[model samples]
Target: MPRARVVINREFCKGCALCTYACPRGILVISRDFNSRGYYPVMVTDEEQCAGCGFCAQVCPDVAIAVYRE
Candidate 1:
């Protein structure tokens, strides 16, 4: 399987969890920590589990996510 890299602009995330719902792999979660904007950020539990499907990026309202295959 191809390895995927998921990069999130933590500061821009609003803890919407849209990506979490969009992920078929179930690798995403909303973090308890707040960002500079005082909003919770979503995090990828494991890049190794990412499928590079780009679903997370597509659902992100902030466009704070990017996915690349490695």
Candidate 2:
């Protein structure tokens, strides 16, 4: 299986948890660090666990997540 990489646009994110909930691999988590907008962004805990399913990106209302398969 190809490896998956998730890129999050922290500046565009609004600290929503939809992506985190939609990730089947449980790799996405809300980070303690805030972005320039003062909103906590989501981070990938384990990129190796990602399945390249794009569920997180699909559910993200902010369109802040970009998933790539490698």
Candidate 3:
């Protein structure tokens, strides 16, 4: 099975947490670190757990999440 790699654009993220809720694998989380705009960004906690479902990217309002399968 192919694995997924998740990338989050910190500059574009607004800390909305929508992607966190959208991830079925529960690999995404809100980071403790802040972005350039002082907003917390979403991060992938475990890449191995990702299923490449692309749910996080689809639900992101800011289009900050990207998922690549390998």
- Reference-based TM-score of each model: 0.93, 0.93, 0.93
Residues 1-70, candidate 2: write the lDDT tens digits.
4398899999999888898888888888999999998999999998888989999999999999998996
Q: How many residue pairs of model 3 clash at the backbone?
A: 0
Q: What is residue 20's positional error in candidate 3, in angstroms?
A: 0.6
- Candidate 1 error regions (>4 Å): none
What are the lDDT figures for the candidates, one per model? 0.91, 0.90, 0.90
Any idea what lDDT model 3 has?
A: 0.90
The per-residue C-alpha lDDT of model 1 at residue 19 equals: 93
Worst 10 residues of 2 by lDDT: 1-10
Instruction: Tell me the deviation in Å of residue 27 in model 2.
Output: 0.9
Model 1: per-residue lDDT, tens digit, 1-70? 5498899999889999999999999999999899988999999888778889999999999999999986
RMSD of each: 1.6, 1.7, 1.7
Q: List candidate 3 stretches off by more than 4 Å.
A: none
Local lDDT at 25 for model 2 = 82
Candidate 2, position 9, lDDT: 96
